[model samples]
Structures are given as C-alpha cells and as structure tokens.
Target: MLTLDDFTPVTLEDRAFFLDLYARYPQQHSDMSFVTMMCWNHYAHYAYARVGDGVVIMSVIEGEKTFRGPIGPRDPAALEEVLDLAVREGCAAPYYVFDEETLDWVKALYPGLAFRSDRDFADYVYLASDLDDLPGKKYLTIRGHLNRFRRSCEPVVEEMHAEDLAEVREFLKKWCAWRHCDESPVLAEEKEAVLYAMDHFSDLGLSGLMIRVNGAIAAISVYDDLNPDTALIHFEKGLPDCEGVYKAVNQEAARLLAPDRTYINRESDVGVPGLREAKLRYHPHHMAEVYVAEKTDLEKRHQGRGEI
Candidate 1:
C-alpha cells in the first residue's frame, strides 16, 4: 500500500509526473497546483497523491502557512491517508479546495468537513482579466475611479524600492489597527506573508507599484506570478487621505502586468460579510474553492461542525 513516507521532494521529474496527471484530467487545475507553492516555500511541508506506482505531495511549513495535498485519484482511502499524514506532521487543519469529485471523497473520509459556498478563504477580493478588454461596466467603473483620482490630486505611480519599506510598514500598521480584536486568522497570516514578500521581493518573484501624492506615499500594491498564466495580487493598502486611491492603484496594476496572463488570483475571502459583498461585486471570472481537513483523531477535538 502507498504510504506518506514514500512522498518525495518536488523535482523536475515530479513536475513532469504531475503535469502528465494534470493533462489527463483537464478539469483539474493542477497548474495552480499546491506542489508549486510547496517548492517555493522550500520543501519543509508537502502534499502527496498516490498515482500509478508512486505517491505525490508538497512540503514547506513556514510560520503558519502551508499547503497539504491536492492529492489525486480521489479514492476515499487515499484521501484519508493524505489527511492523516497532514495532521501527523503538525500542520493545523491542512486544507485545499478542489473539484466536487475530490471534495466528495474527502467528505466521505472525514465526514465532518464543512464547506463554504464561496471559492475564496479570506477577507479580500481579486480583480482580473486584461484591463482593456474588461467588460464595459467594469471598464467604466475603473475609468471613473481613475478620472476622479486624476481630478482629486496629482497621483504618481512608480516601481517600489527597498527604501520605501519603512514607510510602507508604518502605513500597514495603521491600516491593520482598524480591525477588531476578534479578527480572522487567515488575514493575519496573509499580512505576515505580505511582509515577507516585501522584504524579499525579487527573490519571492514579486514586484510592486506605489502611488505617491504630494511627495508622500498614498497606496502600495504588490503581486507575483502564481504561474505562467496567473498573476496574483498579494496585497494593496491605501492611506485614509485618498478618496479613490485603492481603485486607481489596482487599475494601474492591471495595465502594467498585461498582454500575457490569462487570469489573476486575488487569494481568498474567509466569508467576512463585507469582503464577500465586495468580491462578488468584481464578478470574479470564477473562484477556486478552498477547504480544511483534519485527521479523524484530531477531528474529535473540534465540535465537528467543520468550520474555519
């Protein structure tokens, strides 16, 4: 029987293996595959799948962030094994959002797995697609914001520099303080990840844009390629002074990173009410559903409601 120990570091050979499995199942989006995220996080935690003669998984448990398995061959037994390994490794509620087939098998294995109807897992909205060909209504909204911003103040957009980190950190500290004491865990981790990305921008495959008004930074945005076809907007923050700074920064980001990518991954929305409303407003091309799974033993610890 295939076991977790058999799982190995994702190498060129493994990418070829996963790519082949992915091509065979075109409905699966292994292209934004968790394995890639594992590799980037440096092989500390991994997700695995049992396929043919081998098992596949990803690793790299940095701080509180992790991706377990989007393991394939959606058999209930195989899914359980993946979850078991995830818990044994000390990952807290390792999760993934996959096709109904995968989710069904997972639900069968854990029985307590609860699913949020939305595709995102945190309190953020993502806007994607080429800025030019964006639907008329969306295009108009963006244009309207930019026009208003143009008239509101002298806005300058420029590539971010390492020197700006101190000011950016200060601005973000103030922005985060607006949240309540009982805020979301995902949001907190995302903030930490964004800070890490900023400190090591080039190494993290990140690039950013900052908006300055009257010689002071007003808004800053950062994004990176999730894959060859998907660019992910990781973080964006605006000063309270600007009326339309957030909208203008996003519009500018789309303009600058275009002509080659098919989509953008704005990450997740943890079902925060206002965030859900905003993401829905973008009319996301579609959402990638995410989920949390626990070992049956660990499952006994919670009330088994299977939430967050």
Candidate 2:
C-alpha cells in the first residue's frame, strides 16, 4: 500500500527519473513537467512515490490534496493499491489527468468511473510563432501595445546570466514588496516559489529573458522545455514603471523558445477572470484539458435514491 512516507519532495536530481518516464509517455501539460513541479514545490508541495514499476505523484496545498500518475505504463493492481490507500488517507479525489492520453487511459481502465473537466485548470497552449512574430490582424492590439511602449521607452532584451541574478533577486523583492507578498498566503507562497526557481535556474535546465527600459530591469520571464515539441513558461513578472513590458517580455521569451519548440504553454489561469482575458488575447491554438476522476463507490447516495 502507498503511504505518505513513500512520497518524497521533488528536487533537481529527479530530472533524470522524470525525463526517462516522460520520454516513454510524452506530455504537454504544465503541471506534468518536472520544471513546474520543482519550482512550484513551495506552493503546491509536490511529491512522488514509486509504486512498483510506475510512479504516483501528488500535490498538496493547505490541507487539501490531489494525485496524478502511476505514470510509466498502466498497472491495474498498482492503481488500485495507491488509489485505495489515497482514499483511506482522505484524498477526496485521487486522480487529476491533465491530457487526453491519460484521460483515455483512465476511461479504458475503468469504464464506469466519472471524469469531470475543469476549465479553470486547462493550460492555454499556443503556437510559438504566433507569440514570437505577433502576426496577422488578430495580433493588432498586441502589436499596438508593443509599438506604443517602444515609442515611450527603449526596450532591451537580454538573456539572463548567473551574474545578473543578484539584481534580479532584488527586483523580485521589490516586485513582491509592492504586492505585499508577505500579507497574503497565496502571494507569499508564490513569492517563495518564484525565488526558488531563480535560485535553481541552471540546475533545472532553464533559461530566462530580462527586459530593461532605461537600463533598469522592467520585466523577466522564465521557461523550460516541457516535451519534445512544447515549452512551458513557469513564471513571468513585470513592474509598473514599464507600461507594456509584460507584452514585450512575453514575445521575446517566445522568440527564444521557438527556435526548437513548436508550442508554448503559458499554463493555467486559475479561474482569475482578468488573467483569463489576458491569456485568451494571445489566441491559444488549443487547451491542455484537465480532468478529475472519482470512483463510483465514492459518489454520495441518498437514502431513497441511487445518486444524490
């Protein structure tokens, strides 16, 4: 049986383990990538347990928890063991499949199970070329934003280096201080997560871009290859001094990532309306769908009815 003790925190060394698994089962979802797991471990508290020949991954925040994987290949007995243990341990939902491949596998494994889609967690995936070039009339507004910013201030895009990270750290402190990161639980966790990524940037096989206006860092974005064809942006932060620096940094990051990656995954909106609107403006080629699974036996039943 799988227990909490079996799960260990995701770290930089787990890259090889995940990479081998991912090569066998390629995925594009942001959360499935090792880079996302390691960087956001402070926020999500990701951990993994080896279950026979497969692996079981879990994420916890506050006291609530969710699970994914047994990622290698399907093992009916293994899934049954881990999930049953998870239910006994108070995981209301034991599975979150972030792509259609995993969803279909689950459906085939348990035809009677219920799978619920959550748009709030669906990752917005776009063509790297679209973001890099901002082509066509559809991108007119984005182009306008960049043009106005260019007219107002000169924007310089530089590849982030080890030497530049100290000032970048200071910039992040300034950014978080402005948002009062210490006062809000969510922001505080995110602040810590962002700093962790900065500290382990190279160890995680990551690259970043910094946008400077008038010789001051205005915005920064970090990204990593999620799979053979997809690149995922783990974090992007900007300051008020540069009005359109967000747009500028995003495009530049896409340009850097697009040379070898075909798709750019900007990750989930977390049901934030303003963020949803902003990401939608980029015109995602498709969404990396997410589904929550529940065993039929776990569904609530009324005294006189089959389901309630």
Candidate 3:
C-alpha cells in the first residue's frame, strides 16, 4: 500500500522520475510540471506520489484547495485508494485535470463524483513541425495576429532574464489591478509564486518571449515543455494597446520550439465566459476534461459549495 511518505518530493532524482512518469502517462503531460513549478516557486506544499515502483503523481496542497495531476495509474482500485490518501493528506478537495479517457475511467470507478465541467480555460493546441506550412481556418486568426503584431510593434522575442523579473512583476501588478477592478480576489500568494517562477523560469521548462516596441517591454509570454512532444503556456500578458504582441510571441514560440516539440497545451479557462471565447478563437483541436473525485458525499457537497 502507498503510504503518506510516498507523497514527498524527496530529491531531484525523485522529482525527475515523477516528471518522466507524468509525461508518458498518455493523458498527463508537462502541465504537471508547470503546476508543480508554480507550487514550488511559491513554496506551496507540493510533492510527488510514488504509486508503485514505476508510477509517480504530482500534487499541490494550497490551504483548503488541493490540486492533483496526471492521474498516472490505470488501475481503478489503486487510483481510488490514492485519491482518498491525497484528499486526506492534502487537507483539501482533490482534483485531477486530465484528458477525457482518464476522466471516463475515474467516473466509472467513482460514479457519484462531480466536476465543475468547464471548457473556457486555455486548451492545448498542437502545431506541425514545418512552421512554413501553417494550417487553414483554425489558425487563420493566429496568423492574422502575427501579421498585425508586425505592423504595430517591432516585436522582439527572447528568453527571460533575471533582470526581466522586475518588469514582469510590475506588469503583473498592473494586470492584477485591472483584474481586481472586476472584484477578482487578487491572491498575493499566486503573484509571489509567479515571481518565483520567473526567478528559475528557464530551469522550469519555461521559454519567455518578450515583445518590445522602441526597446520597451510591451508584451511577454512564458511557456514550457509539458511533455517530450507538447509545450504548455503558463502566463501571457500584453498591453491592450499593443496590436499583435501576443500573436508575435506565439509565432516566435512555434519557431523556437519547432526543433524540440510539436504541440502546445494552453490549459483550461475555469469556465469564464470571456476567457472561453478567447480560447475558442484560437481553435483548439480538442479539450481535455478534468474532474474531482471523492469517496464521501460530504466532500462532493463541499465541491459544489466552492463553486457557488
């Protein structure tokens, strides 16, 4: 039986092992690393789960909310036990963000569990190795953005530096200020974590693309490898005035990552109407569904309460 001790991120070797397992899990990808990096960057209680000699899981414990990823194992009984342990040790509701196949398996095992059922968040998109041969319809808007970005700003995409942290932090503060204008709960912890990610940004599978106009940082995007074949974007921000800055960053990223991988996992939108619209505009091939699993009816009720 997997014990609580199996959940700690003991060493780099252990971390790498989990990273590898998560990547190969068919459904879970490098996004787990992104989530884990966010937790570690913020010093939030994050760890890995050793389900067996070969299986490793990533988990994050944040106050009353616990997020789990890459549901690695295929055994329903084993996963059920792990879910129970995760919720207990995590001291929060356990959640798994994964593809539809894994979701189907878990739902079959735990018939009564509930999910917020959302598609509005950032979704994963894949690209062809040949950047020159861009696809039709789906990528029309993306191409347009890149074209417009060139007209509006002399865009410059580059790896992030320690010096960029100050600018990124300032950008976030401004962005958060705008977010707060809409009564969004601006979590200081999340900002702290993002800054932390910036500090070790490169080491954490991140490629920062900065767009400059007249030598000033106007837009920036941070993305990293979610798997050997997929990249996941974490945070991307641009000044509203900047015409094609966001698209410029994406095209440049496709160029940079062409040699390394073929897919991009932008992640979910948390059911926000506007965010969903923006993601859909990008035209994702398909969205992976994520769900929360629980053994007790009380925990299910708690999940609904949080949504309310």
Give the per-residue lDDT of model 3 (tens digit) for 216-283: 67777677666667767777777766776766666666676777776666667767677677666666
Candidate 1 lDDT over residue span 186-295, tens digit each:
55765665566666665544678888899877888887665566666767788778788977787777777766666666656556677676556566666666555444
Ranking by TM-score: 2, 3, 1
Q: Which is the leading candidate under TM-score?
A: 2
Give TM-scores for every candidate, taking all chains together and pairing residue i with residue i. Answer: 0.63, 0.92, 0.72
Best model number under lDDT: 2
Evaluate model 2: give its TM-score.
0.92
Query: Candidates 1 and 2: which is better by TM-score?
Result: 2
lDDT, residue 117, candidate 3:
51
Report the Cα lDDT for residue 1, model 3. 61
Task: List candidate 1 stretches off by more than 4 Å.
Answer: 1-67, 70-80, 83-134, 138-142, 177-190, 291-308
lDDT of 2 by residue, 150-251 (tens): 889888889998888898999999899888999998789889888988898888888898998889888999888888899989999999886888999999
* Clash pairs for candidate 3: 30-226, 120-269, 121-268, 121-269, 122-267, 122-268, 122-269, 149-244
